[model samples]
Target: MPLPKAQTLFGYSPEAPELSKAEVSRRFDELMATIDSLPTRHVGASEVAQAFGEGRGIDFGARPGNAFEALTKALDGPDIAKAMSSDALASVTSALEALKAEQPDLMKDITPSSPIGTGLVAYDLEAPAKMLTPRPTPLRNRLPRKKGIGLSHQFKVISGFTGTATGGVANIHPGIGDTTQTNFAPSGASNALYYARGPKISYAGYDKTVAYSQFSVSDAVTWSAQYAGQGYQDVRQLSRTSLLYSSMLLEERMLLMGRGTSGRGFLGAVAAPTGVALTARTAAGSEVALSGFTTNVYVKVTSDAGDFGQSVLSTAANVGVTAGQVVDVTCVLPAGATGVRVYVSTGASDPGDASRWYAGRVGYNTFTLQGALPTSGVAASTITADTTAYTNGYDGILPICTGPDSGYVNRLNAVLSNTNPGSEWQTAFAALYDAVKADPDRTLLNGSDRKQLSDALKTNSSSNYRMTITQDQLTGVTLGDVVNTIINEVTGKGVAVEVHPWMPQGNAPIISDTLPLPDSEVSDVWSVFNVQDLLGVDWPVTQFAFESSSYWMGALLCYAPAWNGAITGIKKA
Candidate 1:
């Protein structure tokens, strides 16, 4: 049937003007659909997988041959009964035919050996560790101090009579010539008039002393957790602060020694005289017998007097070599044979020296560290270290000397041989007191001494020593006995006494442990300047970080020597 006439608005018959437009539009749409059907761009395997997962349609540029999906579909269909590969089908059918042709014998079952018995394999992990106990740090907290900050310091004082005196004996004499003053053999050339003078102005000086400590680390070392518990010094867990603390102790020790660097305010002192032999050596066959040391360990044998010191290497799972091995010691020559030191080591190896072996602690040989043989078999190297005696206790403090004519009248100094300690202590005190009595600076002066003095006092002192008035005059005098007697006498006069561990030890048995000094702030006796307090900072790297800290300070005895006096050679043997 003939279609209705097309209108320009919508129909497409052919006579209307709009018919052409509408036909063109329809043709454009068909062209677009054809273009869309053609492959537009390449899609990757991932895109294919993604599309499949999304259940979306995909053309894949027309049909692809022998695809896995087609094979899979065919296998699932009725074609499953047919062999897929010629070899696989032939082998399967032949094997089936043979099975039907003849039955084969079966073999026995086999099993693998596993699930190891309880003690068969050692699966236990060994954790390596050693106990560390720090040695005593003796100097830091002991010294007496007047804590403050300032520039160079000094103590103001008055010493000798400063100016000439007047009004003693008149130069004009009323002699035999009565009223004729010149006639009394008053050649007047010998009239000497003495007058009292005002106190002399004096000052003591002190300079700063710097004390410091430092440590450093690398990143890898601190970060590795695997190394946490396996070594002698577990540096991973803690900073080795022994060095820093040691330095601090050393500074205090030096100050009290007053032996080294007299010019730098008399710091770093104390040296015993050269002994007959500072060291002793023995050939093999002399090492003492030991049993507790099981193999590698570090050991140190120090003479009780610290006159000699040494360390030895060791092997594992074994104690000392009972019969052979050279043993050398660096201490005062052993007299006859009496070991003076406590030979022991904290670990198997020397923490400060890498060359030394890991010798376990000494005294380990003793079972239970008691009974008959416990301490009986110490190393032959242990021997008595005798000390040389100084002439007197005063000698310990006199590093320098002054002349009577030097106008110092020794007033700037005090000298007294410890002749009769019981009596001389009083004399020494008197000399120091008299020297500064006029200066009026005695108020702040206190006294300090080393542990030796305290030990000496404790050793000799008795209940009677504490009781001065009721004590028997015939009682034996001990170092402590004499020292306390003197200190008690001095303290009653308003002076304070204290223990200073850094004081030089006595060279002589009687006086070695006695550097008791009447200390004072005379001008801040040790005017210390803190250039810097301990400052800790972090230095980080790509792998780890390091913690570093440092401290700086300086101390000096204010120059007023007269403000304080030390009894260097006190003896109460």
Candidate 2:
């Protein structure tokens, strides 16, 4: 026996299948006549069948017996030509007529019997301006604090002077009635006078000149002593130094009396001197009392000397002290002492109180001694040197994934390896797998479809398909390239395309007995066949079966198209 034709075997026999020839012929004639007489009519199945009968192979199916059936059959064709035929066109025309009859206003343009023209009119209309609501009040009205100069001073010394001198003099007694007078004066009177002439100088000198070239003695040399006493008073007013003390009392207590609630015992106090003394003493007379004292206290002292050891005197006790008690302490100013300070603490044994004591009063002074005064005419250049080591430690290895590239897998890996792995990317990958497994349209397929799908994906230029490949199948492809390919394919085919990245599968597992798939074999088959088949002509074969079962056997299938016919075949395998 002759082998059956491929067409017959495939259910498309050479002999037309048993169909109503007279009904099909009548339907074709009526549809063709209607299409020839009407505008805006679409080809129907009858037109497609008539075209087939006119020595043209039917790209679609056999003719239907009526306009509706014929149009439906034509529209279901793989190619557009069979659907755009005379009978199909006539069916569309009859549809238009029926629609016109049903809606008189819509038919008015085509109904020549009516006097109306196109039935649509253009008119200008104005839209009222929209009213705007009042703006809301601001949450805050306070302005930022302005920067101000603290304390500053400047001084200039125009001039200064010092002097030293040495000299010898002799005096002679005058006779009681002698008329001659001897005057004594310095030898360099003009020189001494000139030296004292300046803007800030004044001088006075006793004048006397004595010369002894010869000596004479009386018959009886007698020495007479003359004494004169002049009394002058040196007066000075004694100025007493005053000390000012300030203290802060910080007391904390917790009661655990009821319901066995735990309690915390704390006692802390602080005391500070307005200014430090040059010397401190433990003797009774020199000590001063601070105003505020809690169970425990801390004191800080400040002085112009900026010397902690010399200025600050502190006493502390670990045992809790009375809320208010005058602990004897002494501060003394020894002879020739310039400044002094005292710091006292009464608190827990912990050294935290000592730090606070230093900070509250003595910190500024200690800082000054270390040459850390902000006003020491120093620049901020030193801070840069200290921070250089920290800045240099930050190499490019700490990559920052920003902008569109942030979601890329490589960027995600960079973050995982170098930064934080428990980030959004990991969560996203999990979410994506979950979504794929949850999809209802996914199915199991043979290996051939997987290859075809993979190849299609590799060559397809449609961004929509590209997105499907990456997002739905988890293709691990570059997002930019995927997007570009999808765009090219969609534009080449003259079809509108929309590309959306696949959402992560979240915490859901890729495959589980509780999931929609039955077993690993089913999942494998679905990954190889169903996923690629769903990708259609826009995806690649390699994309479907790019790796062994190790890579995708247990992986969830995703990214089936909503518009695709393959969605109907998906089932639990």
Candidate 3:
């Protein structure tokens, strides 16, 4: 079999020549007929598959050495191989056709007929970003936050003891033995001895009470379950819980407001001015109490008609009546069923015009009258009930300090008015430190900002009086800001200061509630934890409900009363 001869020029019959087109084509045909048989097209996928064998192991030592070696070496290097092997290349190549036939969908969108390129041009062409999410919360990067808190643990416990109990009431003794603190000695050998009993311990008992607060999230259970594995929850849910804590702080601050509704006491009233009372005339033997007299006010009495007036009963001083000021009045009414009248007056008694006088409302200290006064009938046109006695807000530290009695025995020197109230802190504190010094235990002076307080103690700049500021106090405070100072009286020579938020800004309180002091009756805010599980769940009972934590507390200012004294009512400059 000979190959077809190549035609030249006009396709005419040509003479044989060594380099002629017909002779060359004829020779090429003779050479091809003598060559071994070969396939017409390039190697197919099946042919490559055959070369790869069962293992598809590429080997340089196989038939077709250089071509196999080049393709196989590219297999060892990924970048080179990525460009070399593919579905389209496999169809046109022969030596390494087997390798390309086993090609993965590495070029995800590439195909046998597809044009290849580089970069994003050849990458996924639909969009540059991934599919958008519905409500994706970005990861939060911030400092960890701590929320609502209240008073210290000491306020919730008995002053001298520790540990939890259903109710821990500690009885503090005053150590004043021998029936009385005083002893009697006769001049002769016959001093009478009165020896009686063994249980001479005079104990003041202080008890504990509890407080609570609670809150619930809207879809808390559902949301928590949804975001169970997440590090943070929805912003709304976090706020709802934090609000519960805020409520706790609010209640706690009020409890610390010195006094409140009922006996929901904080610290005992230590700053009340004593002898600030509405008293009856001592000389007249005609004493009376007023209905609306909540605070000390002045009054004048007179005998307009001398109806039953034996003596003038008044608060005015008897003898030296200054031109404008009336310290006391001298008046009295006989004991009989007769009407009497009292009038509000800072001036001398006006005898002529009854219309000019305001009748004083009467109560408790009842006295008899011999005859009716001219202006005694009507409830109006005269004095009404006094308003100075009552108030809704807690009795601030001032009133608490002013009014102390037996059991809560703080030595009170009641005065009608502290004229020089500015220097009252020095006088009051000197008394307090002196009384507690004998106990051999330290004391704390707890209070908020008050007038002249800092100025009064500025001289004792040493350890005698220094401030222990809290983290909360550090905020919003500068050099001149009125601040509560916590002073530690460690050596029995100084006093401790605790600036509490709930303490009234006007009337300062001194206590050991925060920093610590010797056993003073007013130190503990007794909280009895009947059931203190603050965060408990109640499903159907409350609508997606969460309860605020709560507890019961009562101020226990009854232990070792003599150990505490407050110098209240100093004004600020």
Give me the candidate number with maximum lDDT: 3
TM-score of each: 0.34, 0.14, 0.30
Alpha carbon RMSD to native, model 1: 23.3
* Candidate 1 residue-wise lDDT, 228-337, digit = tens: 54553455334435435544554443333322232333322222211211111233242443333322323333322121222221121112322222222232322111
Better of 1 and 3 by lDDT: 3
Over 355-443, each residue of candidate 3 has an lDDT whose tens digit, in order, gives 32445321111222112222344322232232112123233222333334211223221221233322333444455544443221222
Error of 3 at 181 (Å): 21
Better of 2 and 3 by lDDT: 3
Query: What's the lDDT for all of these models?
Result: 0.31, 0.24, 0.32
* lDDT, model 2, position 382: 21
Clashes of each: 55, 60, 56
After TM-score superposition, the amount by which residue 66's alpha carbon in candidate 2 deviates from its true location, in angstroms, is 52
